[model samples]
Target chain A: MELVVFSLLNGVLYGLLLFMLSSGLTLIFSMMGVLNFAHASLFMLGAYLAYQIGRYTGFWPGLVLAPLIVGLLGAAIERWGLRTVHRFGHVAELLFTFGLALLIEEVVQLIWGRAPVPYTVPSSLDFAAFTLFGTTYPAYKVFMVLISIGMFGLLGLVLTKTRIGLIIQAALTHPDMVAALGHNVPRVFMLVFGVGSALAGLAGVIGGFALVTSPTMARTLGPIVFVVIVVGGLGSLTGAFVASLLIGIVQTFAVAIDFSLIDLLARFGVTVTRADTFYDLWRIKLAQLAPVLPYFMLVLMLIMRPRGLMGTRET
Target chain B: MPIIRRALLGVALTLAALPAAAQDSIKIGYIDPLSGAFANVGELGVHHFQFAMDRINAKGGVLGKKLELVPLDSKANPQDTQIALKKVIDDGIRFVLQGNGSNVAHAIVDTLSKHNEREPAKAVLFLNYAAVDPALTNDKCSFWHFRFDADADMKMEALTNYMAKQQGIKKVYLINQDYSFGKAVAAAAQAMMKQKRADVQIVGDELHPLGKVQDFSPYVAKIKASGADSVITGNWGNDLSLLVKAAKDAGLNVDWYTYYAGGLSTPAAIGQAGKDRVKQITEWHSNVEAAALDEELDAYKKKYNEDFYFLRTRNLMEMLVKAFEQAKSADPVKVGIALEGMKHQTPTGEVYMRADNHQLIQPLFVSTMSAGMKRDVENTGLGFKTDGRIEAKDTETPTTCKMKRPSA
Candidate 1:
C-alpha cells in the first residue's frame, strides 16, 4: 500500500515534469503550427544556462534568471528566426529547427565539453523530505512537485481569467477568424511561443539539477515531450494535462510492478529453464517495459479513441 | 601548327598531374557516432586522429605524401552507420576505422566481407578500436576486420576469475542492458562462473532496454531482495549513473562491479555519494599508475581542459601511427599485413596486436572508488583510488584466430 502511494507520488512528480515541457510544446504547435523540433534543445539550453549562472551566483538566482534568458532567446527566435523561415512553409520551419537543434547541441558541447555536468540539488533541499514506511524521499523531489503544481496553477489562472487568455483560446479554435478580428495575431503567436519556450526552459533549469545536465538530455526527453503532446491531443491544453498525468502514472506503475508471465505460469505448475528461450519471452519485467509504455499507450489510444481522452476533434 | 602542338602538350601535362596527385594522397575513412549521445567520445577520437596526422606530417609525411582522414558521422544508429559506410566506400576510401558498437561493427564487417568475397583485390581493410563483441573475433569473425580492444569474452574471463578468488562474493546478480554487448557480457560471465566455481549462485539476472530506462528502482529492489553479495553490470552513461544512484537510494549492500562504467565511474559522475557504492574495471583510470601515464594524462587534460574517458581516441591514433611506421608505406595491404603481430608501448603499458584475432593485448585496471581520494591536487569529485590492477600476466591465454585475411 505504501509502495503504491509512493509510486503515485512519484508519478505525479514525473507527470508535472512532462507537463512543464509538453505544455510549452503544445502551445507552440497550437499558436505557430510549427512542431519546433528543437523545443527540447531549448530546455537543454535552460539547464546549461542555469548551470552556468548557478556557478556564478547561487542556485535560486540561477533558476529564476536562466528561464528569463531562455524566454528572451525564444522571443528573438520567434520574432526573427522562425518568422524568416515561416514564409517557406512548415516543413522548412521544422528543418530549420532541426538544424538549430544540432547547432545548439554542438554549441553546448563547445561550452561545457562532452562530460555530464555535476549539477547537485541545493544543500537546503539535500536532506530527506520524509520517511514513508522505512523509505526516505528526498526533499528536492518534493520541491520539484511543489514548483510544478504552482506553475500549473499560475498558468491555469492566466489562461482562464485574462483577456490574453480569451484571445489565445479563440486563436486555438479559429486562428484565421481571430486574426481577422483586428487583433495582432502574429504578436500573440510570438508571445505564446516565447512563453511556451520559457516553460520548457524552466523545466530544464529544475531538471538539470534534478537529473544530470548532459548534452544527451535533449535527445532523451525530446521524443517523450512529443509523445505527450500527440497523445494528449494536438491542440488541447486539458487533453495534454490528462495525457501527461496518464503517461506518468502508467510508466511509474509499470516500473513498480514486478510480476512476469512466467510467474503466472509458475502458479499454474509450469516450470521453465534457461535453455527454453520461449520461457523468457513471456517473462518480461515491468521495469524494462517502462520506457516503451508511453508509445504503447499512444498507439492504443490512437487506434481506440482517435481523439485523445479530453480531445475535441477526431484527431 | 606550333600553337596547336603547345596546347596539346599543356592539356596532356594537366591530365598527368591530376592522376599523380590522386595517387599521392591516401584517403582513410572513419565511421563513428559524431552527432548523438556518443558524439563527444567520437569527437575525441577525431581530434586524436587529427593530432596524430599533424605529428606524422611534421616528421615528413607517410610514404612522402600526406594522409587524409575522411570522417562520416554514423549518428550512432545502425542504418545511419550503413549510409556513412557506403558513402565512404563510394568516395573511394581503401581503409576504414570503425567505432565500438557490436551490432554496427558486425554490420560493417558483414558488408565488407561480402565485398571482399566478390572482389578480393580491391578489399577495404577495417580496424575496429572500440567494438568489443567477442563473436566478432570468434564465430562471426571477418577477414577484413581487426579489433584493437579486448573482446567481451576476454574481459569477462578476467572479471569472473577475480570474483572467484574473492572470499565474500558467493552470490552474484547479473544486470545488463538488453543488447548484443550485454548478452555477450552475461554469457561470458555465466560461462566463467560455471568453469571457475559451480557453487556460486546467480540470484537474479535482469536485462533493461538500452537508452530507455529512466527509473531503476525495480531492478535495485530485486538486487537488494536477492541477497546477492555482488552485482555485475554492463551499463554505460546515464543508465549506469541512474542504476548506481537507485541502488544507493535503496541502501543495497551488494558490491557493484560494472563493465563500461565510462564517465559514471569517474569522479564527476558520483560526486561524494557514489564513492562507496561503485567499483569499475576500465582500460584507463587516472589513479592507475604506469610509467609516464601521469605526464601523458596531465598533458592531455591540459590540452583539452577536461578528463578523458578510456583515452580511446589516443589509443586508436597511436595504433594507426605504429602501423604506418611498421609498414613503411601508406598502402592499405602493406599496413594491414604489418599491423599483424606488431607490438607498441602505450600509455596503458606495452600493447601488441595478436596475429590471430588482431585484438590488442594490454593491461586492464580494476579500480575501486573511495571517499577522500583525490585525482589531482585540486580534488576532482570523490576520486577513484586503484584498489587492484589486472596485469597483463593475469589476462586470458591467447587464442589463435583461424579466420583468413582477404588479399588486398
Candidate 2:
C-alpha cells in the first residue's frame, strides 16, 4: 500500500512534467492546424540556453530569460519561416518543422558538443521534501508539481477570462471567421506559436535538470509529448492533462510491479523453458513494457475513437 | 567462382589506389564517430592518439618514418565502419584505430580480418584503444585485432575484488543497459558475488533499454524498495548520467560501482551528485603516479585544452612504436606479430600482450570521486583519486580465443 501511494505520487509528478511539454504542442496544433514537430527541439534549445544563461547570471535569471529568448525566436520562426511554407498547405509546414528539429539538434551539437551539460538544480531546492516510510521525496519533484499546476491554472484563466484568450479561442474554431471580424488571424497564429514555444522552453528549463540535457533530449521527449496530446485529443488542454497523468501513472505503476508472463503461466502449470516456443515472450516483465505502453494506448484510442477522447473535430 | 572472384578483384582494384609507401611518413587510419552523439568521446580518442603520435614523431619517428594519423569518421555505426575501413585501406593506411562502440569495433575486426586475407600485401592492423566487450578478446578475437584496454569481465573481476573487502555492503543490486555488454556485466557480477560472498543478497536485477529512458525515478524507487546497499551498473553515456541524477534527486545515497563512470561528460555532469560515493575501475587514474606521466599530462592539457582521459594509450603508443622498431618494418602483419608477447613497463606497471589472444595485460586502478585532486576534468569540484591498484597478473582472466596465427 505504501509502495502504491509512493508510486502514484511519483507518477503524478512525471505526468505534470509531460503536460508542461504537451500543453505547448497542443496549442500550436489547434491554432495553426499544423503540428509543430520542432516543439521538443525548442525545449532542448531552452535547456541549453538555460545552462548558458545560468553559467553567467545564475538559475533564476535563466528561468526567466531562457523562455523569453525561446518565445521571441519561436515567433520569428512562425512569422517568417513557417509563414513562407504555409503556401504549400499544412503538410509542408509540418515537414518544415520536422526538418527544423533535425537542424536544431545538429546546431545544438555544434554549440554544446555532443554530451550532456552539467545543469543542476539550485541549492535551495536541492534537498528532500519529506520522508515517508523511510523514502524521501525530493523537493525538486514537489517544485515541479507546483510549477506545472501553476502554469495550468494560469493557462485556464487566460483562455476563459481574457480578451486575447477569447480571440485565440475564436481563432482556433475558425481562423478565417476570426480574421473576417477584423482580428489578424495570422498575427494570432504567430502569438500562439510563440507562447507555445515558451511553454516548451519552460518545461526544458525544469525538466533538463530533472532528466539529462543532451542533444538527445528533444528526440526523447518528442514522441512521448505527441502521445499525450494525441491520446487527450487535439486542442483540448484538459484532455491532454488527463491523458498525460493516466499514461504517467500507468507506466510508473507498471514498472513498479515486476509481474512476468512466465510467473502467470506457472500458476496454470504451464512452465516455460528456453526450449519452449516464444519463451522470450514469457521472459518479458511489465517493467520492460512501460516505455511501449503509451504507444499501445495510442493505437487502441485511434482504432476505437478516431476523433479522440475530447476532440470535437477530425485530427 | 569467377563471378565472386571478379567482384572481389573489382573491390581490391578500387581500394588499391594509393601507394603503400609514400615519403617518410607511416600513415595510421583513425576510424571513429566524428559527427554524432558519440562525436565528443570519439574526438577525445582522436586527440589521445594524435598526442601519442606527436610524442613518437618527436623521438625520431617510428623506424625513421614520421607517423601520420589519418582520421576516418565511422559515425559510431557498424555499417558506416565497414566503408570507413575500406576507405582507410584504399587511402594507403596500414594501421586503423577505433574505440567508441563495440558494435563498430566488432564490424571493423571481422572486415579487417577478411581484408587482410584477400589483400595480405595491404594488411591493416586494428589497434582497439577502448571498446571493452569481452567477445572482442574472447571467441571473436582475431589476429588482426588487438585490445589495449582490459575487457568488461576483467573489470568486473577487479571490481568484485574491491567490493569483497568493503564492509557493510550486504545487499547489492545489478542494474545495467539491456544489451550484450550490460548482460555480460550482470552475469559476471552475479557469478562473482556468489563466488566471493555467498551471503550477499542480490535484491534486484534490472535492465532498461539503452538511451531510451528519460525518467529513471521509477527505477530508483524500485532500487530503494529492494533495500540495496550497493548498486552495480555497466550503463554508459546518458544512461549512466541520468541514473546517477535520478539517485541523487531521490536522495538514495548508495555506492555505485561502475565501469564507465569516467566516460565522456559523466564526471562533469554528475558532479556533487556522486559526492565520493561513485567508484570506477580502469587501467590508471590521474592520481596514480608514474615516472614522467605528470609531464606528459601537462603537455597534453597545454596542447589539447583538456585533461588527458586516455590512460591505456600510453601502453598502446609505446607498444606500437616498439613493435615497429623491433620488426624493422612498417608492415602491419609484422608489427602485429611483434606486438604479441611483447613486454613493457607502463607508468602503471609491467604490461604484456597475451600472444594467445592479443589482449594487453596492464595494471588496473580502482578510483573514487572526491574533492581536491592534483588534476580534474571540467572543474567538476570532484575528480578520480586512486584507491586500489592491481597488477596485470592478478587481473588476467582466461580467454576462449584460439587465435589462428600466421606462420612467419
Q: Please name the candidate that would achieve the greatest lDDT relative to the true structure.
A: 2
Candidate 1 lDDT over A52-132, as tens digits, reads 898889899988898899988888898989988999997899999999899898899888877688776667777777865
Off-target runs (Cα >4 Å) in candidate 2 are B1-21
Give the distance in Å from residue A31's predicted Cα in candidate 2 to where it truly belongs.
1.6
DockQ, computed on Cα atoms, for candidate 1: 0.38
Angstrom error at residue A172, model 2: 2.9
- Measured by C-alpha RMSD in angstroms, how accurate is candidate 1? 4.3
Q: What is the per-residue lDDT of model 2 for residues B23-53, given as tens digits with 9 covering 90 to 100?
A: 6799888989998677788888888989999
Write out the backbone clash pairs for model 2.
Answer: none
